[model samples]
Each structure stands twice: as C-alpha cells, then as structure tokens.
Target: MVLSSSLSHLALLVSLSANNVLAAPRPSSPMSLSMNLKRRVPEARSADDISAWAANNKLALEAKYGNTKSIAKRSSGQNLIVNQKADSSFFGSLAVGTPPVAYDVILDTGSADLWLASSDCADSACDGVPTFKASDSSTFQNKSTEFSITYGSGAAAGSLGEDVVQMAGFSVSNQIFGVCDQVTDNLLNSPVSGLLGLAFQTIASSGASPLWQTLASSNAWDQPLMAFQLTRYNNDSKATDLEPGGTFTMGATNTSLYTGDIDYNDIPDNDESYWLQTVSSITSQANSISISSGSSALAAIDTGTTLIGGPADAVAEIYSNIPDAEAGTGQLEGYYIYPCSTTVNVTMAFGGKSWAISNADFQAEQLNSNTCMGAFFSLETGSNAPAWIVGDTFLKNVYSVFRYNPASVGFAQLSSEALAMNGVNGASTPSATIGSAAATVSATAGTRDANSAVALFHSSPSTTGPIISLLAITMTMFISLRLV
Candidate 1:
C-alpha cells in the first residue's frame, strides 16, 4: 500500500506488568536483527496516484513549515534485509507487549509516532487484524493520557500505554506507544496493523517520547545511527512471500552494505520536522539541463513515500527531456506518463555530492500496454511545497544513514550485492516494448528499504517471548485535500 503520514492515539487498557524492562537484546557475537518487509499496492490506485500522493506531502510540509529553516542530524546496531513491493510501501514485523505479540508495521521516516490497533478497539478499523490485548500482558501500563493525532492523510485517536517492544532481537522495555481504538479505513485495509515513525520527536503527534529516542537513551548501540538496505525484486513474486529481501541495521553501519565513503550532510536544527535538506541542482542527462534555479531549496528524505516529487515547473522540465512524455490523464493531471521505452538519467546534488537516479528508478509502473508512469511527479501547487520530496524511488538506489549526534543524513553507493539485486548493476533487460519491458524490470528492480534499528539484548529461551501478530497502519492521506 502507499503508506502516508504519521498519527497516533492513546487508549486505556487493563494490563499488568513489572516496570522492569529488558535492558537490551544480547547476541553471542556482533549480530544484527532483521525482518522481511512485504509490499502492497492498491489495485484501484495507479502509479500516478502514488507519485501525486508524495507530492501532496511536500505541499503539506510547506504549509506546516512555511518559510522556516530547521532540521537536525542523527544510529548503528543490527541489520536485517527487508522486502518491498513494486510501486508501493514496505513493512516488517516487531513484537510488542509482555509476551511479545508480533505486529506488522510500516516503518516511516516522514512522521513521528508509533501506533497499533488496540485490543479493546471495537471499531471496524481494527477488524481482522492483530490487536494488543492489554489484559493479556503482565507489563502493560495505562498512561491515562488521551490524544487525537491528525495527519496529512489519516488520523488515529486513543490513549497511551507502556510495554516491552521487540524488533528482531533488540528490545526496549517500558516503552510507550499509541494504543489506537479508532483509525481511518484506508489504514484499516492496509496489510500492516500500525505505523512506526522515525522522524524527530519535535514532530511526534502524541506528545510522547519517540521509540528511537528510547533506544538511543539506552547504551545498547555503539552509536546513535540507523541504516536501511531495501531490496526491490524483478517482479511481484516476492510481494506475498515472507522471504528476505534486504536488511535494516542499528548500532553499526554494515560495511558490507555499501561501497566507498558514506557522504553526510547536516540537517539544519531549525528544520526539525522531517529530514529536510537543501539541494543545489537537479540534472537530467537526457537533455543536459540543470533544472534547479534560485538558492538551494529544501527536500525531505522520506522512506514512507514511494515516488519522487517536486515543484511543477521542475517536474515538467524533467519530463520534457524524455521522448513522448506527457501529463497524466483526467484526475491524474500533473503526473507524468511516458513511453515504457523511455530512458533517462536524473541526478540531484546535495551535500556537495551528485547522486544519480538510475534509469530503472524513473520507470515507475506500467499503466497499460504502451504507457508507463514516471516516478517523478509535480506538486499540485509548488508555491508552498518544498522544492522536492525525495521518497523511496531514489533512496532505494543508495545506502542511506540518518545520524542523530550531528543531526545529519548521509548516502553512499550501493555495494555490488545491492546493485545486482536492485537491477542497477546492468541487470539484463527484455527487448519487448514498454509494457513487456516494464513488467520485466518492475518484477526484478522494484526498490525497497530494509530499515533496521538494532540494540543489544540478552534473552534466555524462556524470556524470548512470543511473537505478536499485530498490524501496523499505513497513513494513506498526506494532507487534507482542502490544504491543496
């Protein structure tokens, strides 16, 4: 599914447990906790819609920040390869509560707040998914705090609770998260049960301490850093399979994941919302045009979003460079559609490094027999939207590191192993037209992030706990259309 914004709610649950939380997960050697992420795409929603949704988020951020310039830098520990679906969102599993009930959650970097379906939730939104039964846990505690968090795309209302949450082998005890009794239907239909936000705490909707902060406070990790290794396969074959695709590691950067030096850039502390950055230029090799003008403009590094987005003028200039490219049809206006055979090279300059987006990344999805949607889309009204919203479309091609100490974001070239898996290392291409070609590449080259945040933890067979099957939320709404 096309996961959207972050929102959370607190609810009362009657559960009992000791305040004694697990210090951290302990492994024999240097170990990384990993989870396989799955992807879901709405059959009714076209790729155009997905790209436009990302653009909408850019506009929403503009509305929230106005002209403000504030941002911060920030982990290393464990690693796990995650799975991703073609043209959609990525998800993985984490165990929560005393017994460690497993829940599937969509990891998001665009917003702050961790929420899941409440066991007491009688609403239709919680139907058929995993729920946290507070009564069943020995460590569950009610915060008595009520919250109503609204997002650009969706909302959740409930109360707060404290419990032990585990991702892979990493564990955080007495951790607080939203127990949502009410949520939007789009989120309900999503394969995930809840959402976990990775953005700064200043933007947390529930006014609660963020989960990453909790883990960072503990001396479990070597450093306050996190890395993602998203693997996009050649087709939809891995979409339903619980197979390993990539890795998400915490505490330490896996030297095996990327090649060359990991370049970093500071996120101006003033831009404290998303991991926002200023881009010097955007280049399209097809036309040899430097579309970026004016001073460096802001861009958000969002993992929750599936497509790349920017101002209409900039997006248009990008499409103009491609042969037989045109605006999307009807309600999909503003989105670009191009011949499936389109080949283009686009690069964005940031932190003094020019990161090139492979041609494969631009061929978003096949619309029909002849047309395919481009990953780059135009924000509805660019006057307020950030100059760019860099989503998974581009991030998947690079190894990304979000550092907290200096409050900066970094990117490095994907290793040979990553390039081969993502179809960037000169993977074989079919000779058929855009339709057959896209289907071939989309199946193999779809990019997904294995976002890992690992902390050390020691567990006995008895204390290992059960895996909770809770569902995570996918915020489909970026912002209210009225804001657009």
Candidate 2:
C-alpha cells in the first residue's frame, strides 16, 4: 500500500547502549571531509527514455497523493552497445552497523531520512543489490516500528532501526534509518542499495533527525555546512557506470573545486526543509529571452533529481522563446521538444547573480535524428510547492554550497578542472540584457575567499574524523525521477 509523508510520524522506540553513543568532536580548527561520487548510467539510452521514465514517475506520485495542483504539498535506460551519452545518476559509499558493512547509496539532498534494503527482504526489487543485515551487527537496534515513503517514481516500506552509520571517515552513533523489506521495481533496477537524504529533519518521513542534522547538531564538524561538486558524463568518451562522478564535501567548502566568490542566497527561515532559494529570473541566453522576472518563485537546489522542473505557465513561457519549439504530446506531455542542433543556453539568477547553464546540459538528450528533449519540464504546482525544482542539469555547472547555521544556498563558478570534465569553456557569465528589458543586476565578475571564518564547534573530541582520498566505484542503474 502507498503511504503519505505524514505516515512517517508513527512512534518508534530505539534502544541504545552507553558504549554505542558517539561523542561530538571539537577540532583545533575547521576542516572539510570529501568523498568521491560514482556515476552510474544505463547502457545506450536517449532523451525519450528519460521523458517516459519521468512521466510514469509523476503518475505514480499523483496516484499516491491527490492531484498536485490542488494538494498544495511541498514535495530510463536500455542496454544497446551504441556510444550513447545521456544524463547519469550518482551514488557514494557509506557503512552502517558494527563491523562496517559498506553500501552504495544515492546521496540525495531532495529528501530526508536514510533507508537500505534489508537482508531478509524477499521482494524481487531487492534482488542483486546489497542489503543491510541487522543480525550481523552487534550494535544494531531494531525499533520494530513500520514506516513507508512514497517517491515520485515509487515507494518503499520497512521497519525503523538505529545503528552506527559511517561516511567520509566520520561516524554518527545510534543513527535512525530504515531497513526496507519491500521496494518498487524502479529502485530495484538501480545499482544503489538505498538512499541517504541530506535535507532538514522537519520533512523527514521517518520523523527522526536526518543523518546530516544529527552530525551537525552534535558538532561533528567545525561548520554546519555541506557542499557538492557533481560531475557529468555526457561528454566522456569512455563513460561507464564507474566514471569519476565528482566530490561530496562536508563541514567546509573545497576552494579548489570552485573559482571566484560564492554568490550566497539566503533561505527564508520559514522554508528550511530543502535548500531553497528565490529565483530572480530565467533567461534564454541565445536570444536573451527572459521569463519570471521580478518573480518570488522559490527554487530548490536538489542533487538527487536529474532534470529541472518548474510551474507549467513559467516553463511554457520559457520554451515559447525558442524557435520552432513545440509542446510534447501524449506520454511526452508537460515537456517541450526542440531541434537537437539548437544551442540552448539558459541562465538562472539568484541574489542578482546569473549563472549560465551549458548548452550540453540544457539539451537533455536527442529524442530523434532531428529533435531533442529539453531538460526543463513543467511540474505540477500547489500553494506550498516550490515554483522551480533545480536539479543536476543546472547544478553541474556551478559549485553549490548548503549552509545550516544561517540557512543559505551559495553558488560559484566552476574551476578549470570541473569545466574540463564537463567539456565546457570558461565560467558562464551573466547576460547583459534579458528579453525586452534591462537586466536587474549589472554584469560584473566577483570573488569571495573560501576560507572566510564562520561558526566553530566547541564540543568534545570524537574518535572518528573528516576529507582526502577519492575512490570511484562502478555500478549500473536506470534513470528515474527521485523528487520527494
């Protein structure tokens, strides 16, 4: 049976031993820990595959909940041998329980709560992928409380549990997570064993402190922040399931991964669940067509989602500016199709700073010999829903930082190394003119030092610590919409 987000609040009892409790660490100075993300792309896929997957995913979500337009809720691939370059999904390694059994999970910033397949799961969806065996870990504590979460693509139901969870060399003791005995086929087809949500705990379906919140609140790091540098595979000639995905840094920002000053946009105190920021405008750089100017539409910067989504009217307006662009019909409904040869350069601004999206990223995938699908889709909207859901399509172009103390989202130009992997030139600059009007902010290059002082931790020292080696793992997974 499908479950709503409210179902996650069911009472759960966790038993913890005194020795299993982890002590927060106090460092001499602020430091950062880094983990390598591994990209997994199904063999030989196209834009049509992604479009169909996203459409079906949306239907499943709508069926579980009511129509998104009225509910006002906040919330792919083939095996051909051709040299196909499509959008890729990313996952990273983390260990849970005692004795440290490692599992690769999708590092998602869109949702809260962490869950893994259970060893006792006999569902077909849990076949092949690694499962967490509660019996194997001496530190594991079964809460025995049942829980379920419905995703855009599918759903999973399992029991709640607590254990020592480790990632990027740091461990959080008595971390609450889910052991899923049943999962949809959409998740079963992926290489990832489960998902690790990085959003705030308020929206967690499990109604427990998210792993990131637990670490930050316990002063596990010097600063209450996490940064991501997501890589691309569309340009890689030797792209595989194990390609170098990118970097996931905790505590502090990696100055080396980004260039210039970070343009930090404050997230309103009222909306702290997701890493949300107000989008000032969206301009099509090719013809300088702008939409949603002076609009207060909130945009969620999500790493887990593969494409960009916005309100129907706003998305329709943006696509109308493109020459010969047509709205998709039938299964391709809510999407726009344009010529594959067209260079779609879209720029999105937040806090008066506009970051241009690379043409390669804008053109999601080639739908046919002549037509291609755009990455941006018209998402169903509601009163509390964010107007735009910005995903990896726009994130891969910039260095994104999510801070919790003051609660803000920051973006900076990509470094030369990041640009090289994306096969793009220098950093994207702000457009001088948008549509028929002058730009709100003047075009000027700015810079901010990454080492600037922020909040520091004053807690007790921990046995485990934080960033260094980059290890890439190989796994294959089909692309699907993961919006929460």
Candidate 3:
C-alpha cells in the first residue's frame, strides 16, 4: 500500500502529537484523564454471549420460620393446574344494583395491598364509576375483617370479605378479599369495590396469614405461586378497562407474553408472600438489585410498596447520570435522556451478578430534540427520606411470578405451555419449570442514605395506592406504598 506525501506527513504528526499528550512531563488535566479513563473501562456485557445466556437462563424461590428462615428442605408443591391469560383478558367489575358492572383489575407483584371499586364510597376520588355494594354481589360474604392501608398521598380503609372470583379458567370458591368501606380523596378512579390481596400475608391482623397464603399452604395446586400481568392502560380514562386489560394465572406464563430466559429467587417467607432477599451489601446511596429480567428501579424489585418511593438525591443522581436530564424545578419530575446517536446502557446487579438492559428493552418513545422519554420507575425524593420502589415502570419490563415451594421464595417469568387464557386452556403442553427471584437484594448499583427504609419487604407496586410501611423502626426511614 502506498500513501500520498501529505497524508503520510499528517499521520506522522498525529502520532507524535498523541505521544506528547500521553507522555508529557507533567500530568494532563483531570477532566481529560477522566474521559480517557471512562473509555478504558471494560464493557459491562458481551453482545455475543450475554443475550444468549440471559435468554436461556431467563426461565424464572422460599422460606418459613417467622421473619428469618433456614433452608431445611425443598418444599414439595401443590398440584393445582396453572392457567394464564393476556393482559387484555382477565376482566372484573363493580355491580351496584343491576347485574354487576364489569371492570378490569390490575394484578401487581410490586404491591401487596389489594382494593377495588366499592359501593359505599362517594366522592371526586371515585373515578366516575359505581362503587361496589355488599348487598349487590351474589357472592359477597361478609367476614367482618377490617382493613386499612395508608399512602404517601392518602389512605384506603376497608373490611375483609369473601367474593366469587372468576379467572384462570377456574372459579375460586369463597375467595377471601378486601372490601373497601371508606374512601381516600386522592384515590385515582373510584367505585373501587375491593382489592384482592394476592400476597401470601397481610398486616391487617396480628400474626394472621393472608388468603393467598392460606391457598398456598393448602397446596390447592401442584405449585404454590401465582402469575399475573396488567395491560398498559396508556390513558387518563381507560375505556378499554371496562372491557378487559389484565390477567391472573395459577400455574404458568402465558405464551403470548414476551418470552426470555428466567432467573428465580425464593421468598424469605415460606409462604407465597414476603418476597425478601439478602442485601449482599449496603451503603448510603442506591441498593443493587439482581432483577435479571429487565432494567427497572431498585424500588420496584420490592413487593412491600404501593407507590415508588426513594431518596431525592439518588433520584436526582440517577437522572443526572444520563446526559441532558434537566433538574426538576417546581413541578417537573426529572428523567434520563440521551442523544439519538447515543446508546443508553442501564444495568443492575443482583445475586452477585450484573445484567444489562437488552436492545428490545431499550424501546423508547422519542419526544423532541432527537431525545427519548421513558421511566423504569418514578422514585421521587419523599420529604421523609431515600427509598427505591419498583413500580409499574419497573415490573412491566419483566414478567413477574410468585413461587411457593422448593425454596419458599417468589418466582417470576414462568415457562408453562398449557396456560389458560380468555378463561380457556388455549395451549398444548403443561408447564415444565417455575422461576425464582433473588432473595438477596443488594445496594451495589448506587449509594445509600444515612437513614434508609427498612431492608425487609413483603411486596409492593408502582401505581397510586395505599401505603405500607416496610421500614423497620431500626432503619428509621419511612418507605410507603401508595395505592392506586
């Protein structure tokens, strides 16, 4: 190969210039060194193998013994058949006087409290709908169970009762659930009759097991876990809600849902509720989470929250990590941003392993200036303290499932084939393996606060809902789950 005389001279000059920059007698500017140092760090994951490994291992845990546990043996599971549906399938409603007015219910793992449209409630808080009346339902069995859940914005108080729940192609006989009697002014849309607490346990009663917990303990099915998903209602008023936009499953993952490799963790609690993990390490910044399914917030990975809550500084730091994320002035919530040409890489560490957000997970809705907008979770700085919640923004990115045995942990992302849908078994094969999640939630991804919320959690979600204080008095940080 031959090069022109000018080209050769230019190349020689560039080489000499670079040598001078690197080998200068004195040190270069700190900013210049930082740029070079960042460039030198190894890539977080390999494009060739990471995806394949995640795809394979991605098929989607246990405990018992009070607040703590010891792995005694693999829990033999119940044998109930597992059936699943799409987000737009499972439907519910509030019946005032006439035939029950049907409404869709959002089953969330990110939260533990459950509530729905109530009949006795009346206020602007009730989103233009009929509340549930105890006298209307053919199946409302009053148990005199009192329930009250608080939130960052407000609270929802109710009672315990049983109802006829029709889903998963199977009817639950006298399914026990929470019936809201009073109303909170901030509740998004109302007529919310009652909430079905799928959690294995509830705090309403001292040392009381939840309805879902009772079912799991009884081994009503071959497995102890339940799987669910909520259809994204991308509007202020969701007309599609009156139709069907949610799903609840007993045994496996719906095939129509996005399929990937699954990672599993056993709940620290032996029952289906109380999803807990060991914080491999903790500091004063952000907790590292091994949420292998997709990138969300550290908060959503938890099951003890109703709304996403966290430290203000950390939220600001997270937003600042991305270029062009403006500071929140008055009402504007800060968000991450990147140039159209820039590839955004977000990742978290769980169970001593680090995972990156896949390309498909990077789907974005471009706003302007060739920028994009999306949030894995809305963790604003609560006036109280720093807490991270994995809400809808977080959970929706991954297919979350609960596991009851073998390890007594919550499982996510099932691989069952014969999953039911539209109230029908629409598949050919039965489920092979149920997945588990990291029982150890770490704080490696970021720093922690001087005062952090309780490291212990049972479950939580990212919508507007009543708050559950997972914070232990020892921790002194108030982390609340706001109900929707």
Candidate 4:
C-alpha cells in the first residue's frame, strides 16, 4: 500500500578542493547491481481456496478504512479438480549488520521503509522466519524511537535503529530501519523476512530515508534508477516455490531483457509519493468499449501488489464490455467472473502509448466449467485514492524502470526470450473439469468482524513521533489460482 504525504526534496552538496577550486564531478558510468528474484508459489486445489484468498483481500480493504472485520469462512463443497498455480510474491536476499546477516526481503515499490523481524519478536507470524539480532552488529545503533506501520492486511510495531545494509554487492551505511518486536500473522511470512520499499521517503511511515534513497544520496550507483523484469511461470506444474523470477537491477537498465526503445512517462509533480502516472485510457478489444478515459484515470505502478485494481465503477464498466461477465457475490463480492471461453483482450495506455495485457494474465482462476475469475478487482474509492492500481498483471508485460532524479517511470516491450517464457506469443487456453464447481452465486451476504486496529504508541527516549495516519491508500496482497 502507498501512503500520501508532503513531498520532500533531496539536495546533493559538492565539496571544493583545498585550492578553493570546485572539483569536477565523476563521469557517469553504466554500472548496475543486478540479482535474480525468487518466486513463491502456493497451490490452490479448490474453489474454496480461491474464495478464501479473495475474502482475505476484502478484509484487508475494510481494515484500511478503520472498518476491520472478521472474515467469514464460506465453503462451496464443489470439488473443482485443477492444478492452479498461485504465485504470490517475489523476493530476494539482502544482508544487514557488520557480518552481513542475510535475509530474504520483498522488493516493494509501493511503500517506503525497510523493516525486519527482530530476535525478540514473539509473534507467531515471526515463527520459522529469520530475525535480526542487533547485538551481533558492531555498528548497530538503537535510536530508541518507537514506530508502528499499518498495512492493508497486517501491522508491525517496534523501535527504530540504524545499521549497515547490503544488497547485490552495494552497501548502505547508517541506514535507518525498523526492528520489529511485534507483528501480525501477515507481516513476516515464511521465506520472506521483510520488505525493502523502493518508493520515496515522503511516504515512509518511520519518517526516515528509505534504503534506496539513502543509497542514492550516498552516490552508491552509477545512475539514480532501478529496473525490473518480472518472470512468469504460465502454470508450469514442475515449478517450485523458489523458481527463477527474472532480474532486478539498480542504476542502469538491462538491454538484453527488453526490445526497442523504452517509453518514459512523467510522474505528476504533486503526486510523487508513489510512482503514480496518468492513464490515458483503458479499452477492451473484444467488445470495443472504452472502459475508462480522461486525465483523472490515474494509476499507481506498484510491484508489491499481485493484481490490478480499479474504482468500483470503472471495474463494472470494464466487465460491462465483456459478454457474460457476471459480478461475483458472497465470499467474492468485490470480484468478477466471466465465461472461460471469452477472450478478454484488454489494453491500457499511459502517455498515449498502449500496452496489451496477455490473456494468461487477464483471467485469474476457473471457478466452474464456464466461469473464471478476472484479475481486476474493485478497490475503495475516494478523493485520496488513486483511480487504479497497476500491479504484476500489467507489469510483467514490459521492462519497467524507476528513475530518481527526474522521477519518471519507464516501460519497454519484453524481449523475444522473455515473451516466449511468458507464453505471450502462443498462450494456451485454460483447461479445467467444471462439473463439480458451483456455477452460480447468490447475493452478497456475510458477517465480518473488524480486524485489530493499528496500534500507535510512544515510549521513552523516542526520536520520532507516533504515526498519525497512513501515507497513501495501499491495496492488500491478493493470491489466486487458475487452470492454464
């Protein structure tokens, strides 16, 4: 989730020589810190699994608006035999402290802050996950500032600290981050220690410079930019939880991962909290209906989110153009379902250059013989919320770049090898045995108990104030399965 805040500027100071002559700046080089990402795949064997996933997301949304609720567990005893690959997240390794204790963290572009589970974290969510032992680090500095961050799904609260953080051969000294002693079940899941936020420092809940910003301000990169090339499994049965997930590069773009020129889109000056941009239009070729248009159709390009989300009205408009696209009810209230055979060729434009979404990425899961879930969901709408949230559903189609100086997001067509691996050229239709799955849904009716409220408190020797509000509207994590 992205939080909004007053934007802050970063200034670089140049020092002069003893002769009182200004020293020449170093020549820019094409140096890059690159690494491979690992994907986490969770299998969903039945419709109940899919419903539970969607329900979890709904609960998170409610919690974000101070309406935390208990999720109702609904089971439609329909045995839908399918091997649905629910690839949930991608993470990579980074180290902290003097000896560099390694931990796997999700490279998130949506939020700002770097946090890891502490050895004192007794929360069940921290079980089986690695924790950071501050005593082991010689350069660790406990700021004694109590901090808490509320996510759409979960929350974490602990004290702030500064340490040496290393990633992909690049080390950032005296980087301020969170050392969580308390966390929710969703905070530090297995195989994922924490998150490395790549967004700006303005949206940081801890009120500290993010890891990327600290590195950039220290001149750790040849270029002040980051690029990503996310990989897809296409529902490969042999794929494991730690499958190859493409590349993550800092400083420069990888030409081999993409083709043609990169299209750079400007981020609005006022909306620099997240990597937000104006989406010119969203159109569906199947029904020839313009689902959304105009300058107000803004979107946040986030890597932390799994699927695409839009305003309820825009989501309904999108499904209106697809034949037999029915709105989901019951446990899947905020989702949409359509005929499995329907070809949903959806394309979106940023800066008037349209990018096509692969059919494999458009549909989520096959609920029954003829019905399948759509990847796009309805998010809470308001004056502060972005109209759309663009996640992996759209990002996997292009080579994405996040620049810092000018603060622009860039996209390029995937290379031939990348496209072939994603099944873009000749993707197969979803295959499923639909006789057992429920084909019809009733009106939305379910009881929800509010989740735990976000905890905020200040302790002794605190260096920062308590978090007063969220920085931006962030979508909860979404997990789903589908036959391919």
Q: How well does model 2 score by local distance difference test?
A: 0.55
Off by over 4 Å in 4: 1-41, 59-85, 286-296, 423-484
lDDT of 3 by residue, 186-296 (tens): 333222233333443533221234434444445433345654443232221212222222344343333334344445654333333334332222221133323212112
Q: Which stretches of candidate 1 lie over 4 Å from their true place?
A: 1-30, 33-77, 189-191, 217-219, 234-243, 286-296, 380-387, 423-484
lDDT of 1 by residue, 1-484 (tens): 2222221100000000000000122223444333333332223334444445434444343333232111121123343433433434445556566544556566667666788878677776666666767786777889888865555444578998877676534455566688988875445433356777777787776766566655544433455666676666424432442223456665557667788877888885456667777776777754544555542367877766656667778788888888889987554566788887667788886656888886666776565657776777765323433466677678878888877666778888899876665522221211111000000000011221134222222221222111222111110101000111
Q: Listing every candidate in turn, what is its Cα RMSD in Å to the true structure after a full C-alpha superposition?
A: 13.0, 14.9, 21.7, 18.4
CA error at residue 150 for candidate 4, angstroms:
0.6
The residue-by-residue lDDT of candidate 4 on 162-270, one tens digit each, is 8866544344556788999997765554545666777788778888877666545444445567677766764444454344455566545666678877788888755
Model 4 shows how many backbone clashes?
12
Candidates 2 and 3 compared by TM-score, better number? 2
Least accurate 10 contiguous residues by lDDT in model 3: 31-40
Which sequence of candidate numbers ranks them by TM-score, best first?
2, 4, 1, 3
Q: Please give the CA lDDT of all the candidate structures.
A: 0.53, 0.55, 0.31, 0.56
Residue-pair clash count for candidate 2? 4
Total backbone collisions, model 1? 82
